[model samples]
Target: MTATNLLPRNRRPADGPSPGSARTKRRRRPGLMLTLGLTGLGLLVVLAVVAPWIWGDRAEELGPSVHLGSSGEHWLGTDALGRDIFARTMVATRLTLELSALATLIASTVGITLGTLIWVSGPRIRAVGLRVIDVMISYPAVILALAIAAILDPGPKACVIAIGAAGSPSFARLTANLAASVAGRDFVGSARLLGVGPLRLMRRHILPNIAEPLLVLLSVSYAHTLMALSGLSFLGLGVQLPDYDWGQLLAGGLQSLYTNPVEAVGPAVAIVLAGLSASFVGDGLAAAANRSRRADAPAKATKPAEANAAAAVGTAPAVPDDAVLVVDDLRVLRKDGTALVDGVSFHIGAAEIVGVVGESGSGKSLTAMAAARLLPGGLHATARTAELRHPDSAALDLVAPGAENAETRRRLAVEIGIVYQDPSASFNPALKLGGQLTETLRVHLKASRREAREQAIEQLDFVRLTDPASRLRQYPHELSGGMRQRAMIAAALLTRPRLIIADEPTTALDVTVQAEVLRLLRAANERDGTAMLFISHDIAVVGDLCDRVLVMYAGRLVEELTAEDVREGRARHPYTQALLAATPRLDTAAAAPAESAGGPEASAGEPASAEPVRTLAAIPGRPPQPDERPPGCAFAPRCPQVLAACHDTPPPVHSPAPGLSVLCHLEQAGARTGETGTDKPLEAAR
Candidate 1:
């Protein structure tokens, strides 16, 4: 079956971040130094911006002659022209800093925009743009600045343009490379499928994730711009005379270096300090932001609350009742023309959750993504035939043999929404949550501006985010991990989609949050009758969430049964049986004493007590690789139940009942014998 058809339709509200957490962790090394540096920089900036008013005519006044040494009248003595070095230094520092800041801003804005455009544009456009940027970078920046300065009037504007142009190529390349890499992430694909258009996607999703690197580049480039401006001013090709620029001061001081080296050293020190401060602040912020992100990472493994909630959600729905999604003969082919998913088929009913469980590399997630028409890059479904069934209409073939068209895909997107594993990576960090949420509503629902905004806020509320309206104004980073995932769900629900594909949605979250999210999803499904195709590596989670389960092995469906059937020890396929045995059971005898133990005895029991450990029987070997399939059965090599005929011929799919199916030679043989399939022993199959 097609992967897109694997997911069911149901979506819960978006979750927000943890409350009362510090905005970010404190910076570690150089914290005090960084603070001082920033403070000094801020003071310098203030002096520069207000230098005209503060220094005024006094800046141009020639102080007492014989300006060497710190006299009471002239601090740090005076320059060759007898201008007060203290005043000139302050004014010069201001002008030079201004020039650098403007140049840096211009360079960053132009470069990042161009880079992102190239990254997202068609391949031919990106190729051409990259080549142009490469050619620009080939020229020495200083030489280019010199030529440009000579062509234009040498002043602040000229310096700004020169430095900005010189820096553009580097920033462009950096931004483009970063954007391209982020675009390839699964979250980007999720955003696109969420109805985020290219422009909004770049602004909202692409920009935020790339901001930290861009900020670092901005700081480093600011230092470069300052130096470049100084070079041009020293050469008399930047900041005109009487402007009191540091570069000009330095050039003036050069003539009298022997008489007063302090003149040169004074302005030189200011320049160095400015650059150092910028670098320090950038480093500090970057480190702090990174630490904050790491600390905020959701906990792994299921939490007690989440497990309890899953258990409280009740039983899985019976199958063949109201199939929400259906797949037939779905196949994914490699570039070498080999099939990965080979003729897989399955079905999920309304308000029903279907679990696709498999060992690593078993094409589980691949099958689920295909159901959403979201296969990995360059991997196409060669022969897909799938459908999504709704209460009001006939089943829609998502991948009809010859009917893979844009309209069909759009229809599927409007009806089916997918939530991926990584929530942080999924959102556009640059954009506020409100904008991202509104975009989804506008696109699929054609919601008006006011209506979209209102709906966006409402959707946030649906996800249980407190103060949803205010949260909308905040950016993705402002929210916690769980909150981001919740926002993703809110965006998905804006479409009122009938089917939701949750591909390991809770994998990245802490157990507590994962439980909340699972409860929310179950509520959405049961209350709204939206079907869901829930995919996960954790069989235990599947057993808790899904009503029916489809076990996949090496790209093919190995078994299909109700969750109850699997729990009650009715799994027919050997792979399915192994998966059931592998689930961790908390209620087992091993868990009872551990729960009751206390103090020193409990600690001692943890080390030596076997207590009938509820051990999972792990499958012995790695699952079969796509390129290396066994003849009769994919599991034969790993199967403890292997027989001679299993290696030579493929097993027939056996359906003991209307809704259950298994592919095993043993089951077929047992049926062939006069024995009932129920009497077949697990060891005999192994």
Candidate 2:
């Protein structure tokens, strides 16, 4: 079903949830499971605390005779050793609770610290530590506990120590995953650009974001500790036998079960109750956490930036005199000699929207990042010649000294605005939507708080957000997906940057919202005279909106098409043609025509069958990995028109039309006969 059909029938185009929903679930305590779980847990706590005074002072004193049945003044009867069963049960429960709680504390402290540290560490340390953690994670918890118990003193102290050590690995793994996820969010990237220190970022943003998940993990850890404590005691490695922790009591009572089963039955029931309580509470917490996240997630299946110089346009300027951004052979490679983006080059004229289209792993995003020089943590990016000449700043090499540092970031922020795919991740959860936007102004424009707030309001209005003023007070979770996206665009535009680098900014939105956002971006490009490098996986969006569409495959630009070329399905490269053909169409059951499949290339030799193939034409095989790209053409292995020469020699780029280029042997040879040229004027290519 389409995103529009999934929404409420009466829903307005620009609307969102109530502001109250954005309140973090951490503070919301109500819910049947939470209440019941807490009540049950509280009861357990009270029982453990008052346990010592509940039974008579002499818990160990002999009660009349051994194996006595329930009688007046001797509730729960006497055990095999003539000890009062009631007194022994209470004492055992108290000791079990105490040791398990201590164990959980130790596990949480050690695990969370180490996990965060390992997650943020350099690649070398992260790799070695992760391998060690992997080995530990593979070990059975029982075995881990047993080993620790065997190594240390074998009593309650060792029992707690063993439980903590055994449980720490699980907590560490959970924390690491949580941290990694938080690190991937766009807000974290924003913070980094704003010069937030690594330590500060984690403490303020990462930790709080992971708090709810960590709370659930803590509950699970408690359950693990309880089980370890009992199992250890049962194996005679826990609290000393005479002191009577839960497992030891049960074991001692089992000896006389045939004669008096109540003694053994009682402790078994206690263990079951304690375990059930923790599981119930943990499940409740997990459910609540999930609910909060779901509520925060904008409901098309959900639902789903910048610039200025950028601000004046009555008519499109015939082409700009000089390109605003230019790059000559940009390369992105890892230290391991793996090339992710190979010898890529492109330019954006002022106010021109250039769209990069490719499938996953086609290096579309990596190429876009080359413009901002934000090519992730370890990889290196260099351009034979890279220049960004913004209206407000002198031209600077994108690969110059301190390029990866704060100085380059300042230039980028002023000259180029970046919008990401997931708007929800782009804004900080804890900050109000207005505050984040305003902070951008305060940082880049050096606007005072009041001035920033005013400018932020103007930006919000510019994006046509509803109730723009009130929205400033709402946290990101309060807004719908579309609203958040508009807010992100507003943030990007705050600096009035001359160019915008949008990376699949519309991929997360529904068709209607996507169309709306595309309109906004187009207006930014045309009205504000701001150029754009639009990166997207959506071919349709590129066809409808971009002036020039670039087809990237396996780290190489295979084809360049004009808006008319893409709209008319005139892709010249087999890879580009395959991409167009693979896209689903609602107009007719017939697959895209032969011209659409490989443009004229797919039908270079064969006559069109009387009936066009109705089946969707899909290109087989995935894109080659960075280290596995073919020596010649990367697409040759999957290309329908593959030739021996195609596999032996890479095809050079050819211009079939003024502004249209393709990297295909057939297109390069002589496939242009009888074909119409692209719509873009020849001068546009110059």
- Against the true structure, whose lDDT is highest? 2
For residue 221, model 1's alpha carbon misses the true position, in angstroms, by 2.0
Number of the top candidate by TM-score?
A: 2
lDDT of 1 at 501: 89
lDDT of 1 by residue, 1-686 (tens): 11211233335576544454443223336576568668978888888888777766666886567547667877767876677787788777767887898989988889988998887786689889999999998998888889888899988898889888888898998887777667766667867666556787788677877788788778778877888899899999898876758888888778778877777877788878887888777776666555222212222332122111111101122336577777766777655555667767776777778888887777778777777766654466743346777777676765544454555646666788777788877666666777767765566566798999888787778888779889989978888788888887877777777888888888898666777777777877876678888888776677677898888888778778887776665777777767766665554655656556664566564645444434456667787666667667888887756768788677777777877777788875663322212223333433
- The Cα local distance difference test for each model comes to 0.72, 0.74
Clashes of each: 33, 7
Q: Give the per-residue lDDT digits (tens) of candidate 2, residues 1-686.
A: 12222332234665554557665443355366667767877888898888888664657787557787677755667876688887888867888888889999999988888888887787798778777778898998889989999999989999898889888888788777777767767788776666566777788778888888788888767876887798889889998956778888888778878887777776787787787777768877887764233211211121000110011111211234468887766667766546677767677888788999999988899887777766676677776667888555578788764655666666766677889999778888976776677765677567899888888888888889988889999999898888899988988888887789899998887767876677788877776788899988878678778899988987777777787877676777777767666665554444457557786667666755433443346567788776666667888788666667777676766665666667778865664322322222111212
Candidate 1 differs from the real structure by a C-alpha RMSD in angstroms, to one decimal, of 9.9
